[model samples]
Target: MQLLEAKLHKIDRHNYRSYSSMRGEYTFVDFDFFIDTVQADPYAPASRVRARRKWALTDLAWLKDQSQDYQRAARDFIARQFADLSQQENGIQIDRPGQVILDRTAVVFDEEGIELRFRINLPADDRKIIAKKAMNLMTFTMPKIIRRSTIARELPIEEMKRHCEAVEDQVALRKQLEENNLLAFVADGSVLPRLAGNVDLPMANAIPFECPAELAIELDAPHKGKIRGMGVPKGITMIVGGGFHGKSTLLNAIESSVYDHIPGDGREYIVTDESATKIRAEDGRCVHNVDLSPYISNLPMGKDTAAFSTQDASGSTSQASWLQESLEAGAKALLIDEDTSASNFMIRDERMQALISKKDEPITPLVDRIALLRDQLDISVLLVMGGSGDYLDVADTVIQMHNYQALDVTAKAKEVIATHPTRRTSEGSEILPLPRTRQLNRAALKTMLEDGKFRIQVKNKTTLRFGRELIDLQALEQIADSSQLYTVGWLWFQLAQGKGWEKQPSKAFENMLNDDWFRTMPHYGDLAKPRAIDVMAVLNRMRKADFK
Candidate 1:
């Protein structure tokens, strides 16, 4: 045992805001002293014994670990040093690895004491480490403290674990929301209305429809591709595309999206409209020979007179009546394909077309019908048509089901709109400076045609072939740089039919028709007759004056 004249140095006066620490050199001067000569104080000092930290740092923390009793000796030494402090206010205080400080009887001292000092070794391995830790500590960062405060240079392992857990919880909640399948339905035919109209969200429209971000389904060949869903208005939406292009599949999938059904049946999306009536038809039965009398009146037209029926007595007056009843039944949307009409145009013809129009009165007819259904009934129509049908003329927005899925046909729509000239017409336009109306005026053609330039055709036999007219050849050559010229020829041919007014069908015209205008324009193989016929109808209606 050695005794020394003990002396202490105060290194720092300002106490650390949180846990306290101190340091001072302990130099033991061993000297002779009789065991019986010691004197004790009258009263053991009122101050309690406080746990002391190591003032002098050794060369290595684990230097003593090399010995056989390394762990036991080190632990026991620390225990003896803190033995007196444990009985003080509450417990002992001691430094642990990884910068942990435990207090109370569980580990270390309890009484809150002002920090005495921080020892600095002139040149030692711990100097840099201590300095690094001191520099990293930021004071006054805790918002809950409200005032100035200080924390350890490093955060506690437990606090860090808790912080990471909180962050993970937040991430998990977001993922759950994404997985929640917001589709509108239940197995019982119910509807979970959408929250908003984001294109990525399942619920897109305010009514019942949802704009889908990525809608994909496995279908038979010729119908492989993603079917995108756009936001539908409160009114009808038309999906027009060519045959064998997966239109019906898309419609069926849409129905499935509402209610989760099997792939061929339902179960894709959960639709809550269990009570909602779905009048879908497959094969020919209901679609092929539907009785118009159920919905529209059986008008006594001589051709359809095999079964005598009263027009007034019938619940339905025409094919339009069937559609009308569906609308009246509070049906959200009508999905129709080819061969539904009694008359190709409609039962009431102009009347039916007028009822489905964007507006009423002024338009030839469609505008009026569109206004009635959209404004009054709130029912939407999903019509699938081939070729540029009359319904396309009134459609507010057309979503085509081409390439086996749904696509917005806005480009085609805008092209048709651009062709439709209003009152304003520039002087150099190829499309004639038309009047305000979109439909070509049959009366105007009679006034403009001269006897010499006119070639009349009766019974439509001699009117198929038409030559191409040059329209800004410089632009045409630029566009046809490397691609084929199918589209280019079609455009010029339309111009020729409209302005040139062919007097005779020429061999050159046939050659040009067969030539490659552009590889892109639709191939007219089996579809050639229909394509040719549709083009001629437009040509016959267009006047030479319209091109001027």
Candidate 2:
């Protein structure tokens, strides 16, 4: 602590760049502080720092003995606490988590103790450092925040326990999906609708979800115990309803349920398969060497879709590419919403099929292949369809969401198919081939970094700036946080260290994202663990990437 104060005092009123000399470790009375990186200008990014306290001193040593998931939740809870505490101080800031609790690097636990990784703005007047202000913020305000967050007594003990238990319960429920033969589970009382299109919070007076008697199943939570929810079976399931009837809302909840929500977030008890991917029509997105022959083939002028590569793809082509890419990255189930999907890609009506004969038409819609995906590839699909009944023929489970409540309409859908049968022939091949694993060129990633001076920036959850390329990720609905994107960029950086092509990029990423995923990356608090499928999905959107 004295060393930090002396360094600040020595640079009193000096230019902001002079504070760079303060980049080093310092020992405080109760904890040890390390200034890892210093900011050059006051307006630049905040200085990186870490404060670690011994487990013996924290009175929270029992956390070290908890399960890995429990410990991760505890760390996340502490980071949220530190963020709340430091909110009153302008200079001190920590990465605040959102509704989902992710495995983040903000608050980490090691054998020795707990460490809080955060940033300090380094108080400055214009371009000059203010020594007293810096001292007050770091030595006084920062330490207090750290201690309050790390110490068990200073925290809301009951609330923290509830938070951790909620997370554990969600994990337990997710593990029950495969055994129950379900793709997703939404608790009977879950609030499916959000406040608005822009907000992610639960609506105040929205109707709670009620599973029909036929679809309800029970799962056991380690803490909560005996959770009753709607079990969306591992097959072709369609959510069908009228406009503004909560069909999309139910699907949205199912998609987001792939990640466990925080307590009181309305969807906390809901759980989905982690490998379920929500894919939609992303127009103008880049596609690299993806096999889209199943959905599209024999284009004009003798074009081939077996190795489709496009800088600007149409809605149907983009949707097809995303589905194939998701499968290649090990997606077990797919979530689709008609509102955001391509009309032609989802289905071709009987009238259109008769008008434009199969020989002349090159495109094959998803309606013909959805069942094949389930039967041949052992993949499940959950779709929200409002305008079409063609899917009713292939749907094994039909759920109608009426005013945020679900009804089992499988029998009704079967009745509809029997009464008003269509003559539209299935356009795609009978067998659905598994997606081929495309090798990624490490040199291509290296080139992207070298061309842009090695920079990685994330703008919310919509975009990522890696090297010189600005990849748009607005269509990836399953990315729980922007911090996950940060980790994705760094993961690519790690992958770039090698030479030649990576044989199986998805498996390689899965291996890297093991229990201690953050250890290999830079010691930054803004990193969160991302799924291997999402990592590969982002890479597929990079226009400069080379895949074969």
Candidate 3:
């Protein structure tokens, strides 16, 4: 601490650039502080720093003995606490987590102690350093915030326990999905609607979800005991309803349930298969070497779709590419909503088939191949459809949402199929081959970084600027946080370090994203663990990427 103060004193009234000399480690009375990076000016990005307190100092060392999930939740809870406390000061900031509890580096736990990674904007008067103000912030305010967040007594003990337990329980529930032959579970009383289109908070006075008795199943959580919820069965399940009837709302909840939500977030008990991917029509997106033969075999001028590559794709082609890419990335279940999907890609009616004969039309819709995916590839699909009754013929389960309530309509849908049978013949081949793994060119990634001076930037959750390429990721609804995107860019940076092509990029990423994923990267608090599927999805969106 004296060292920090002395340096600040020497730089008092000096140019802001002098602050760079203060970058180093300092030993405080109760903890150790590290200024990893220094800002060049007051308006530049905040300086990165870390405060680590030994386990013996914090009565919260018991967290070290907990399960990995429990420990991750505890760390997230601590980071949230620090963020809340630091909000009073404009210059101090931490990477705050959202409703989901992701494995993040904002707060890390090692064998020795708990470390809090955050940013600090050095105090300045115009372009000159303000030594006294910097001293107060670093030596007094920051230390207090660090101690309160790390110490057990300073925290809400019961609230922390509940937070950690809820995450642990959600993890347990998700593990039970495969054994129960389920794709997702929505516990009774979960609030499905958010406050608005842009807001992610639960809406006030919203109708709570209720599982129809026919689809109700019980799963045991270590902390919450048995939880009864709607178990969306494996295979093709359709959610059908009128406009504003909460059909898309239900699908949104299930898609977000792939990650564990914080307590009282309204969907805390809801859980879905971690490998579930939500894919939609992303028109104008780039497609690289994807096999779209099952859905689109023949094209104008005898174009080959077996190794499809397009700089700009149509809605139907983009959707097909996403589906095939998700399969290659090891997606076990797919979630789709008709509102965001391409009509032509989802289905082609008998009238259209008759008007344009199969010989002339080259596109094969998803309706023809959903059953093939379920039976041959062992993949499950949950779709929200209102326009197409054609899917009823192949659906294993049907649910209808009426005025925000769910009703089991599988029997009714079967009855409808019997009374009003469709004349549209299935358009695709009977057998669906598993999507082949595409090798990624590591040289391309490295070249991109080199061309752009090795820069990685994230814009909210919608865009990633890796090297010189700006990739659009607005269609990836399952990315829980922007921090995950930051991790994705760094993961690609590691992959770019190797020479030649990566034979199995998805599997390689899966192996890198294990329990010790963050250990290999720079110690930045903004990094959060991302799913392998999302990592590959981001890479697939990069226009400059080369895949074969």
Candidate 4:
């Protein structure tokens, strides 16, 4: 503390140049603090102080003591503390907790110690520096704030840590889903509904989720001991019920289960396959030479479906291309809701089949090939439907959501299908081609870069402005946080660099996943760990993406 105070006291108040001189290390109780960055101008919101704290090896051993899930929980717990401390500080530049993001680091059990990185507001009067005040902030105020919020015994740190552990435990259970043949799970007592149409927080007076005894399964987790939940098996599964009967609400929870949530967020225990993606119709979205022959072929003008490209695609064609793109990205399970899906792309009923001859129709619809996706491609489909009974014949499990309760009606649905069989003729190509590597138009994409750095800008939660391209992510329902978008932006920046990106997009993504800087950056802490496919979605949607 004396060392920091002395350095601050040595600086001249009016000489703002002294602010940069204050960048160094200071020793405090139980931790070593290093000032990694200092803001040149104190009055500017951009002006900031970045620091890192290293704790004792033994103190950290407990955090990384358990499995990967435990480590992720502990890290999340520490990040929560960082946010709380920043909010309580009341410091001039350091009060915003939003800037404190723990790195989205992989949970490893062999860690020797834990280090937390945070940014503080370096106080100043306009452009002039306040040396003594700065000393008080660094030496006295922030230390106490960090201790009380982070290391002190007063806060419910243990309970918060337990919350992260529970969420991670749920995430761990999802890893065994493929081997167990389960697509998704919702724990008993989980609150599924949101507060309202606009709000995302758990709804007041919402119904708690209870697994029907018929489909309830028990799994042993590391932290939560034994967990009993409703398990939705693989293959084509449907959630059907009347309006506002929790059909969309139930699918909403399942799709969002891809990322771990905060403790007490109500959906914390919900788990879905990591590769599960919500499929939707994206009208006017750009498509680049994707093979859509499986769903649509023999166009009216004789346009080729096998290497299809479109600048402004219709609802059905856009949905078909998006499905093929998702499959190319290695989707294991697809989450689809009828409300967001294209009517024609989902089903061609008997009436429609009879009305239009096979030669007259170019579209095959998803129903015919959905079974093939499960049986041949080993990909599962979870669809939310209220209007269609045509899907019952292909459904392995049908869950009826009535007033927020799930009823396993697979047998009843099958019986209905047997008694009233649909004479709808199936239409689809036999083979679904896998996605191949795409060659980048490096010159056009490089135009978006600035002075060797890709100018990545985030417009909002629903949009990402990458260079001149506006990638629409409104259809990507699983991307819940803004940070995930930022990570995607960075991934595009890497892709735009155009060096060593000529290989398969998946391979390039795997290499980026292993990069040291990519793995440990502060941006990673804010990330939800999107799959390579999600990253590819951004690239595929880029309007400026000139692929060879």
Candidate 5:
């Protein structure tokens, strides 16, 4: 084992620090016997004892130590000799041999932020008999222990090292994420288009802009080694995972960023975006209460008397309806959720566009309205989603939120491209054209919140100040009759994440259509779990309410 360790240290980049140890046996007889047994039957003996090429599984295992394993040998054999023959054939020496090692790495699953342990693999075929034999035995041991016990699942350490290397390689092929920029969070607006559905950045506008690739944050922050920020990519970045996996808390951290942070949010996404709005679901819909029954067909002309307040009105637009108009009036970015009534990619597309298609159309659709504002008006939209659609097909980037973490599908797409070079694109495409227009109004978004305040700092000195309107939390309590309380809460939470949520939740549904931001939210894709259902229904209601 020490000699093998010595050999590995001699190999560049795959070496673990070595210290001389006298614990291992110096004799070759027992070691050879152990080796011969493993070299034959890795799991069971092929023949009785003393038979040529026959060995006992027990004899080989009894010789196994706490560290060395059997599966290690077969894996090393597979890696160095069998793993990357195609790479070698293609002139890429990505694999040496399927070598086994004790190297380790911790990988974070999506947004739930679960840290899964993985073994690193080395490419060398030459390995000590002790280590190789142990790993093969583990392949059997792992599945059993996982189902019944809390034991750590043993992975081919060499495989982990190789896979981690492969992960970097896959990330390298993508142009948007830099090597140094990777394994961390990115908050740059330029990266926004990827999440925001390939929407172009607003140039020469009221809002300052930075390219996604140009913006840099770190994965490790404050007391750790420097790296780019964790991903909180723009467009509607969603955090999804199983229960107790931290989805609502993920939203909480984002909400923290919108206001003055005392401890500040630990989430990399909010820290990076220099956000525009954070909205909660409790706020009712923001929309114009024009008699929709005339053009909107089924919608009732329910006039507000004691129910809807005229005091805090942003004019005739109700929370849901005004969003469509505000976005048309020009709001740079908007984030809402499944809490609205939006659903399915193709269905939403047809209905949403119908409503936004010219005034007086009987069937109204939010998608068409949003598109009009995005293409014709230049407002970007960001709303949450939970199912499939034309949205996914048209999405510039799809962020799969398995856990609490966020990974741009653009990253995943690049991975598929790397393994299959024959595949279309292995890298991020060129920057799309966007009209550099429209200044971000942080004050407007905050005024839509409870005691929301705005502070802007540029070039180290000049500061712009904006004040927010006090939200009547009591009104939230009073408006139990409204359909958008959750929608309001959701939008508020989004704004609080440092981006700033300006419109009421209902407005988000109306605003979402015909806009770029609507294109980015992660989709649950028709799954009806508790967390996803609570969120998706809210978004759908707000969306459907517009056409109704």
Candidate 6:
């Protein structure tokens, strides 16, 4: 406290070097505070003090000792503390201090001992020093807030602990996917619907999901012990049922299961492979140097699809490009819904096949090659179909959603398929060709750079305003938080750094995984770790990306 107080009288607004000199660590009895970021102008809104509070492992062990869920809840609990501590606007009793801030990922447990980022405004006297305000804040006000918010024995941590435990249990369940030969699992009692269109909260009257005995598989999760759920095995699995029968709802749940949820969020135990990607037709999305020959070929004008590049792609072309790019970025499983899929890309009925005549048609529908996706490429596909029965012939397992219940009808569907054959010709049996690695021209990126600095601004959770380009991520459903978006934007800037990023984008992710930036997740605050595929999904959509 004295150290922070000593620098109070020495702040020089004009030089700003006086403020830089004051940036250092100050220790209290229970925790140490390291001033991480110092604002140049103390009066500026962006000009603020960023510090981290580190507590002993013993002090935080109660939060993390039990399960991953408890640790996550503990983080949420601590973050809420700052909010709860806010008495009023411009609170904290300090002169001109801003609201206490904590990033979302700050609560997630890493190897580091429990630490949380904090930001508060330091008062300045005429752009110089406000020694008395600084002294009162550091020595009296700030300590009281920290003591109450963090170390108060009366505070409720148990509820948060249990919540975190439950959340982490879901994560643990997802990690066991490959070992169980399953791509996804939805626990018998999970709720699958949100309250409304915009509200993410689970509906009060939503039906609870129940797994059929035939499809139910039991697993010993770390926290939940023995749990039984519907395990969608590795291969082509189709969810086919009547409209408003929870087919898309179930599929939506499974697609989002790629991210772990909070406790009591109703879909907590539903787990999918972390590498699972939700693919849909995105018309007008940019496609850069992607090989669309497998899904599409022989354009009307004799256009090339081997290295497809389109500034404004059609529905069929965009979905094809999205799939090829996902494969390039190493997607293991695809979650697709017919409602959002391009009709032409999904299937070509026998009547349409007769009308178009195979020779005249440039496109080979997904129904023709979906089986090959599994058989040859080892990629699992989970498709939700309401109008198409053609998928049944190619489906390895059929799940019919009835009144929000999953009924395994593989045998029944097979019988129906045998009785009434569509006789759809298989188009391509050859495996999807490997994605060609791109060599990014650094000059293109450098030309986009402003003032010799890389530019990336996240407009929202689903939009990245990168330089002059707007990378739309509305269809990238798995991005769970705004912090993840912020991290991805910075990550793109990081990828643009140094050399060799152009040669192999996938390899860049692999090498970056070993980097301290990837391991530690630096610069961007509290980030949910995103897959390389998610990053590539955004980049592949960038119009300014120069790929060779």
Which candidate has the highest lDDT of all? 3
Q: Of 4 and 5, which scores higher on lDDT?
A: 4
Pairs clashing within candidate 4: 93-121, 94-121, 102-525, 103-525, 104-524, 104-525
Alpha carbon lDDT at 210, candidate 3: 94
Q: For each candidate in turn, give its C-alpha RMSD to the true structure in angstroms.
A: 33.9, 0.8, 0.8, 3.7, 24.6, 4.7
Superposition error at 441 for model 6 (Å):
3.6
Q: Where is model 6 more than 4 Å wrong at Cα?
A: 1-48, 61-77, 80-113, 121-145, 152-155, 429-431, 451-453, 511-526
The better candidate by lDDT, 2 or 5, is: 2
lDDT of 2 by residue, 1-548 (tens): 98888888999999889999998889998899999999889888899999999999889999888888889899999999999988888898888998888999999999999999999998889898899999999888888888899888899988988999999999999999999899999998898888888889999987888899999999999999898989999999999988989898888898888887889999999999999999999999999999999999989988779999999999999999999999999999999999999999998988998889998887899999998999999999999999999999989999998877889999998898999998888787788899899999999999999999999999789899999899999888888899999999999999999999999999999999999899999999999999999999999999999999
- Tell me the TM-score of model 5: 0.30
Ranking by TM-score: 3, 2, 4, 6, 5, 1
User: Which is the better candidate, 4 or 6, if ranked by TM-score?
Assistant: 4
Per-model TM-score versus the true fold: 0.28, 0.99, 0.99, 0.87, 0.30, 0.85
lDDT of 2: 0.92
lDDT tens readout by residue for model 6, 1-548:
66776677555343433566666788766656666566666664322232344455226645545643445456666666654664552423211111111125543345555555555566675667566775676677666666665653645666655656666677678878999899999998898998887667788988888899998998777667988889999999999888888998898888877766766778888889978988899888888888888888889898898988988999999988888788878888989999999999999988887788887887899998888889878999999998989999889999999988889999999899889988767776466656676677655665565533556666466887776766788887766665566666666666656665477777676555442443445522345455677877877777888887
- What lDDT does the true structure give each of the candidates? 0.28, 0.92, 0.94, 0.72, 0.29, 0.72
lDDT of 3 by residue, 1-548 (tens): 99999999999999999999988899999999999999989998899999999999999989989999999999999999999999999889999999899999999999999999999999999999999999999999999999999998899989999999999999999999999999999999999999989989999999999999999999999999999989999999999999999999999999999999999899999999999999999999999999999999779999899999999999999999999999999999999999999899999999999899998887899999999999999999999999989999999999999999999999999999999999988887888999899999999999999999999988799999999888888888889899999999999999999999999999999999999999999989999999999999999999999999
In angstroms, the error of model 3 at 142 is 0.6
Query: How far off is model 2, as Cα RMSD?
Result: 0.8
Task: Output the worst ten-in-a-row residue range by lDDT, candidate 6.
Answer: 93-102
lDDT of 5 by residue, 1-548 (tens): 34433433454332221211211222221121111111122222211101011123112222123122222222232233222322322211212321112111111112211111212122222332233423332223322322221111333344433433322322222223333432123333211111121221222222211223423344432222244434443432333334543334334333323211111112223331222333333334332232322113322364542122223332122333333333333344444444433232113343444555433323333443444434554444444455423243223344543443444455554565556443111111122223221222333444444443342111110111112322233211111112123233333335444553334443343354222221232211111011121222232222212211
* lDDT score at residue 379, model 3, on the 0-100 scale: 96
Model 2 — which ten-residue stretch has the worst lDDT?
423-432
